[model samples]
Target chain A: MQESATTIAIAPDQPAPRLLEKAVVGAGARVGELAEADALIWTGKPRDFPSTLPASVRWAQLPAAGIEDFFDAGVFTAHPAVQFTSAAGAFSHSVAEHALMLLLAGVRYLPEQLRATSWQQREFFPHVGSLRGKTVTIVGAGGIGRALIPMLTPLGAHVIAVNRSGRPVSGDNIPAGVETVPTDQLARVWSHTDHVVVAAPATAQTRHLIGADELSRLKPSSWVINVARGSLIDTDALVDALTGNSIGGAGLDVTDPEPLPDGHPLWTLPNAIITPHDSNPPQLRLAAFADHVGANVARFVAGEPLEAIIDTARGY
Target chain B: MQESATTIAIAPDQPAPRLLEKAVVGAGARVGELAEADALIWTGKPRDFPSTLPASVRWAQLPAAGIEDFFDAGVFTAHPAVQFTSAAGAFSHSVAEHALMLLLAGVRYLPEQLRATSWQQREFFPHVGSLRGKTVTIVGAGGIGRALIPMLTPLGAHVIAVNRSGRPVSGDNIPAGVETVPTDQLARVWSHTDHVVVAAPATAQTRHLIGADELSRLKPSSWVINVARGSLIDTDALVDALTGNSIGGAGLDVTDPEPLPDGHPLWTLPNAIITPHDSNPPQLRLAAFADHVGANVARFVAGEPLEAIIDTARGY
Candidate 1:
C-alpha cells in the first residue's frame, strides 16, 4: 500500500523547517501539494491560522510542547475528535539539568562570590552546602522527574518522587534506591527535603501547588527549582519565602507573567536565581522531541498506541 | 609486664598540667614523679623547648597535617631516627567538597549573575558550560583526589587521575570507570580536559606543576579548581591565565599567602573566584584528624602499620 501523503503546515515564524518536515512526513513523501495531504503539522502562533482547515487532514500535530495555544485558538474545543499529544518529554533532560544547575549553584553560594569579588580572601569566605547528603523531593515524577532522579542519585542524594496518580511508574533507569511518594505525602516530604524540583504539568489542580503554606514546611536551607511551569507555584508567595529566608532560595526557569517584567522584585532578591524560561540547552529539546515524534509516527503507521497522549479533561 | 611507663616531655610554655598529665604520663599516673619515665612525647613548640630534646623520645607526632612547622623547628634533623608522623587525610572530604563547589560555581556562572542582577530580565542570559559532559583532570590523586572522584563521577564527568608513580592506586570508594594517567601525559590530557583539579601535596619537585606553559595547553572553556596547597600552581602564571581568559576560570581554596591580601588583582579578576584558603568545613579537620590520630595510636600500641606516615625525604 502507498504511504499516505502528509502536509506539514508550520507557521511562517517557526525557525526550524527541516525539523517540522522530518517530524511529520518522515522519509515516505515530499512536501508537494498541501491541498492533497492526509496529515498536518501546526507550529508557531496559531492566531494567524484560518478559522477552518481541510477535511482531508486526518491528524494535526502541534510543534510546541504546551497546547495552551491550541486552546486559545479554540481548535481543540472545535475539533472534538482530533488526536492530541504533546512534546512533553521533549525538554525533560534539559529541564532536569537546569534544575540541577540551580540547586548546585545555590548550595555552593555562586551568587555571593559573584557579588563581592573584592573580598576574595581565603580567611573570611563563607561556607556553603553540598548536594552529597540531602533528600530531594521531585514534584511530578514524570519524564523530567525520572531524568533528574538518576542524575541526583549518583551525586549521593536521596530521591523522592511525588506524582498525581499516587502510583509508582516502572523503569530500570529509575535510580535503584529511590523513594516514590504520592502527592499526598508532599507536605510531609517538604518538611525534610533539602531540595524541591517542580516538574509537573500545569493543570488546574497543580496551580499554586507550592504556595505559602507548603513553602513554610521546607527547611530554611532548602532550595526550590521550578522547570515545569510558573503557575505550578504561587509567585507572590514565593517572593515572600525568599525575602523572609523561610526557604533558602529558588532557581526559577519559569515564572508567572513570564518575560518577567522589568524591575520585578525577584530580579533584586539576593537568593532568587532566575532564568528566562529558556533552560533547554542547545539541541537537547530538539533531539528529545524528534525522538518522541518519530516513535509516535512509527506507531501511527503500525496502528499502535501513541505514547504521551494528552487527556483534554485532565488538561495536561 | 606492667606496661612499663613511657615518659613524655612537656615544653615549658605548653599547657603545663594537661600536657604533663596526658602526654608525659598516662591517665592516673603519678603527676608529681615526672622524672621517672622511659620515653618522652614532645608537646610544645620546638623553638621554645631546648635545641636538643631528651634522647628518651622514641617518636614524634605533630598536630598539623603538614609537618613543615615541625621540620622548620629542626625536629626532623635533630632526631632523624625518631619515627615522625603527621595528621593526614584530615581535610580530605572538606577539600574535595570545596573543589566541587568551585567547579560548579565557575561552570554555572555564579559570578556573572551577581554582577548583572539589575538587567537580568531584559535579555537572554548567556549559556554557561555544564559539567554533565566534561573530562576532569585530577592532579595528585591522593586522599582528597580519591574522595572527589566519586562525587565528580555522579555528575557525569570523566575523571583522569595524574600522579607521580603512574601506577594505579586503588580508589576504593572512588567511583569505578575512572581513568588514571601518568604525570608524563599531563600536557596531552590538559588540552582535552574541561576541568583541572589540583590536589597534589606541596613539594620542591611538584612546585609550579600548573604554570604558564602547562596552562596554555588548556581549552579556553576549561576551569581549574585548586584545593591543594597554593604553591603547586605558580600564582603569577594563573593571574595571567585568568586575565587573558586563556583558561576559562579558576576556583582557588588555597593561595600562596594564607590571606590573599586585600586589593590583590586576583580578587578583582572577573573570571577568577578566590576563597580565602579556608575550604575546610566546620569541625571536619578536627574530627578527621582526631580519627587519624586515634587510629595511629592504636597501630602504635599493636605494632601494626600506621596510616599516613610522612616520608621525611619527600617531605609530603
Candidate 2:
C-alpha cells in the first residue's frame, strides 16, 4: 500500500516553536491546521485542551510524563476516541544521568572529600570505590531504570532490573546480559547487589521498599540512590544507616518529608548527598519533548505501535 | 602457516596470580616458566626484575602506567631486544569515571546542595545543568581522554579532543564524530567549549596550560575537571575564576605541590572539589592491569601489534 504524508497541529500558540515544527517535518509529516491535521500535539495544560478534536485527528501527544491533571480536567474523556501518548521515556535520560552521578559520588567518597580542609589521601585510600564489576539493582524497571542500564553497562556494572514481572528489559541502548527479577524477589537481591537505585513509582505496595530490613542486608560500602519519589525509602532507617556507617552513604534527590524540612538530620549528615530534586530541570525539558514528538510522529507515519500509550481505564 | 601456542611467565610469585593466569588463558595463551616462556608479565617491584631475559622472550607486560622507576632501575637498558607494553590505558577507566562524576557534580550545583539543610528546590532549579548538547573539550587524547569519550557520548555531549598531533581519536569503544584539534590551536577553543577535562601529562610546555588567559575566556557556567596533574592548570588563576564566578566550578583530583598545604584556599572554595590524587586507588589497579594483559596477550598470540609501546627517550 502506498503511504500518504501525515499532518500534525501544535496548539496554544499561533506559530508553534521552530523545534517542534522541525520535528514534525523531519518525521516526514507537515505542520497544518487542527481542522485538517491527522494528529494533534498538545503543548498546553489540560484546561487549555480543546473540548472537541477534528474527526481526522486520530491521535494526540501530551507534553507531560504523568497525565493525572489531564484526566482530572477531562481531556481524556473529551477525546475518548483519540489515541493518546504521554512523554514518558524522553525525560528519563536526564534523571538516569543524575542517578549515575549520585551513585559515583557516593561510592568514591566525594562527600567526605568535599568537606576536607587538608590532603587526606592516606586516610581516605580505603574508602575510594569503583562500580566496575559491581552489581547495581534498579527497582521499578520503567523509563528511568531502562535508561540507566545502558549508562551503567559502559562503566562495567552488572544491572539487575526489577519490575512487577520478571520479564527481561531490552532496548537498543540497553546492552545484553542484564539480569531481570520480579519485585517479589527483591529480598534476594539486597544481600547480593552492591548498590541500589530507587526508580519505582509511589504506590502503596512500593512504599518503604527499602526499609530497615533491606538496608541492613546491603554491604557497608553500598550506596543507596533515590531519583524516584521520596516514599520508596524509609527516611528514618536511611538516617540510621548513614549515622552508624553501616552503609556507604545516601544520594537523594527526593526525601520522605521532601524539601526535607530545615534542620533535618540529613542536612548535617556527612554521608548524605542531596540535590533538591532538580534532575530534569525546565531548561532541558523542551528539547527532550521535541525529540519525543519527532519519534512518535515517525511511528505514527509508519502505522507502528506508538510509545508510552496512556491507558484510559488505569488513568496513568 | 600455523600459529604456535604462546607461553607467559608471571614473576616473583611462584603461583603469580590466579586472576592473571585466567586472563592469559582466556586470551588463548598458557602459563609457563621464565626460562621457557615467550613473554613475561611482571607483577613485582622494578628492583626485582631479572637482569637477563630468555632469548625466546619476545614481549613483556609491565604493571605500571608510568615506568620511571623501571627505567631508573635500568630494566629497559638491560633488555633491548624485547617489546614492552606498559599498563597505561587499563587504569584510565577508574580515573575517567571519577572525572565524569566531578564534572556532573559541579554542573548540577551539587556542592551547594550537599551543604543545604533545607529543601531548596526552587533556589537550586536554575543552577542544575545538563551535559546534553554541550561541548566538552578534553585536553590530551591519551588513555583517560579516550576512555572518557564513550562515557560522555551516552549522555548526549559533543566531544572535542586536543592532542599534540591533532589526529582524530578513534577506538573500538569510542564513537564516531568527535572533533580533534592540535594543541597549538587550543587558544581558540576556550571561548566555545562548555567544559574542560585536563587529562594531559605534566611537561614543561604543559605547565599552567589553563592559566589566566584561558580561564578568563570560559563562560560563567563552564566547569573544569582535572584528573591529570594539577600543574596543568594555574592555581591562582583557577581560584580567581571560581571566586569571581567567572566559570561554573572546578573538580580537581590532583593539586599543586602534591598534597596541598593545609591552608590552601582550593580546599574551602565552594566551587572547587579536591580528591587528593586518589582517582586510581591501589585496590582497583590490579584488576585493571589484568584486563590490559588479556588484550595484549591476545594480540601477541595472533602476532598482531600490541598497545602502549613505551619510548625510552620520552620517559613517559
Candidate 3:
C-alpha cells in the first residue's frame, strides 16, 4: 500500500488522544489542516456542515456503529459525492456477550436468591430453569446476530434467525442444525421461542416493531433481550407484558427515553435488568473508529470499493 | 431376543399400574408367581433379602442413582453373583446446566444488581466481569463433566478436567479442545482458574479435599461452584474465604452440613448463592433410575458388564 497524505479528524474528547495516536500512522494533520489533505475521518457528535470544504475530500469514515446520527445531521446529502463507511462489526462481540449475561441472570432467578440471603431463608432455594435445549430467536441477521449465533449454538440451543429481506443466508459459524426463519413469520415462531434477541437497526419502518400485538403472541415463559435501539420495542407494551406475566422477564440494555427518569416503573420491576446504556465495552468506540479510518484510508489510495458505504435513501 | 419365561419383581411401593396397562408382548410373571418362571427382573427399592432366593432371580434392578444405601444394606456385596447397576447418566444434563447457571449468576453480579434496584439507585449500575473468555476447571472427569464440556465449550469458555487416576480417554461427542489434568495439580492450577466446578464423587480420599489450604490458593477473583457431594468442600473454610474476599464468590448446591442451620454466617454472605440440595431437575432421579434398570436387564441377559458398579473400597 502506498503511504498517502490523509487528515484523520476526530472529536475533541478523551478518546481523541487514542484515535489520533492510532489512525495517524505517518505525518498526518488534524481537521484544521483539511485544505491540504486527501480524505477526512469523522468521529464525533453530529453538527452543522462546514461551508468552506475542499473538493479533494473524496471519502469520510464514521466512528459510530450506526450512521443515523450523521444522516440526521444531513452530512451525507450535502457531500453526495463523498463515500461513507461505518464500524458496525466492531461492537458485536461485546454486545452479544452482554445479552447472554442478562439472559442467564434472569432465568436462574439470581435477583430473588440474592434477596433471600438477607432473610435467613437460604434453605428455601428453588430450582431455576436452564437454557439448555431451549429455542432462541434473533430478530436481525446482521453483524451482531451473526456473531451471537456461534456463541448460542454450542450451548445446545436451537437458534433461528429473522432478517429484513425475504432471502435467507446461512450463518458462517452457525451449526447446520439451527433454523432460519423469515421476519414475517416471527409471530408463528414466537410462542415456541424461549429467548428473543432484537439487534435490528433503528429506522422509520423498524420503530416499535415489538409492540402490544407481538408481546401478546409470546409465551409466559419466554424472555426478551434488547441490545439494539430502544425504539424497536414499545416501553409501555413491554412493561405491561412483564407485569401481566405474559413473558417471563426482560434484559434491557437500552430503554426508551434514554437515561430513564427517576421512579420509572422499570427500575423497580422484579423481572427486569436495566443498565445505563453502557453495555458496550470500554474503549470499543475508539478501537472501532480507528479501524474504520484505517480501512477508508486504504481504499482512498488503492482506488477500491469502500466498506459499509451509507445509502442516502435508506438513511443508515 | 428369545421368548423366555421371565419373573418381574418389584418393591411393594412401585407405581407400575400405568405400565401394566400398556402392551406386554413377552411372557413374564410377577415376582409373586416366581415358581413358574425361568428368569427374573426387579424394580424399586427392596426392603429385605429372601432367605431362600429363587434360582430364577438372574438380575436385580434397583430404582436409585446412588446405590450406596443398598450396598450398605448388604444387598450388592452379599449377592455378588447377581449383576448390579444404578442410574447415572440421566441427571448429567440437569446437573451440568445448574452449575453453569450458578457460575453465570455469580460472575455477572446479578445478586448485587437486584439489591440496588430496591434501594432506588438505578443510576449506580456497576460493571461485573464476563465469562466469555474465562478458564473454568471442572474437577472429576466422569459422566457429568463429560456432558458439561460440550455445553460450555460453545459458549467461548476454556474448560479443564481433573480425574482420579489422571488417565486420558477420548469419547465420541467430547470436543477436541478440552484439557484433562490430574487432581493433584488442582492447587497448582487454582491461581489461574476463573471458575472451579466440583463434580467429583464422594469418596474416602475426596472428603474435605477443598479445605482451608486449597481455598487459600484460589485467586481473589476466582469463584467456586460445587455440584458434587456436600463432604467435598469444607464449609468453615469456604465461609472464611468469602468473608475475607480471598475468593470472589461461591455457588454451593451442597454444604458440609446439609440443610444449613437458620442463622449460619454463610447464608448471610452477600457474595454467596446458596441453593438447597435440590439443584437436580424435577423428575431427574426417577428418569435416571429407570434407564439404569433397563441397561442392567439387558446386560444380565447378554453377559455384559453392568453400568455404574460402585467400587466398595473407593466408596463412590
Best by lDDT: 2
Query: Among these predicted structures, which one has the highest DockQ?
Result: 2
lDDT of 3 by residue, A135-201 (tens): 9888898877887887776556788888877456464566786677777677777777888888888
lDDT of 1 by residue, B86-156 (tens): 77665577678778778876776656654554445334344455676589999988878888887677556
Query: For each candidate, what's the DockQ?
Result: 0.22, 0.68, 0.22
Each model's iRMS:
3.4, 1.0, 4.1
Error of 2 at B88 (Å): 2.4
RMSD of each: 8.5, 4.3, 7.1
- Predicted model with the maximum TM-score: 2
Off by over 4 Å in 2: A1-10, A13-40, A54-59, A80-83, A294-316, B1-9, B12-39, B45-47, B54-59, B68-73, B80-83, B294-316
| DockQ of candidate 3, scored on C-alphas against the true complex (2 decimals) | 0.22
- Native-to-model Cα distance after best TM-score fit, residue B191 in candidate 3, in Å: 3.5
Model 1 misplacement above 4 A: A1-90, A118-127, A166-173, A283-316, B1-90, B118-126, B284-316
Grade the docking of candidate 2: medium
Give per-residue CA lDDT, model 2, range B16-134, as digits (tens). 88889999999999999999999999999899999999999988889999899988988888898988889977899999999999999998888888878778787888888888889
Candidate 3 residue lDDT tens string, B186-250? 66777667788999999998898888998888878688999898899998899999999999899
Model 1, position B295, has a per-residue lDDT of: 56
lDDT of each: 0.70, 0.91, 0.69
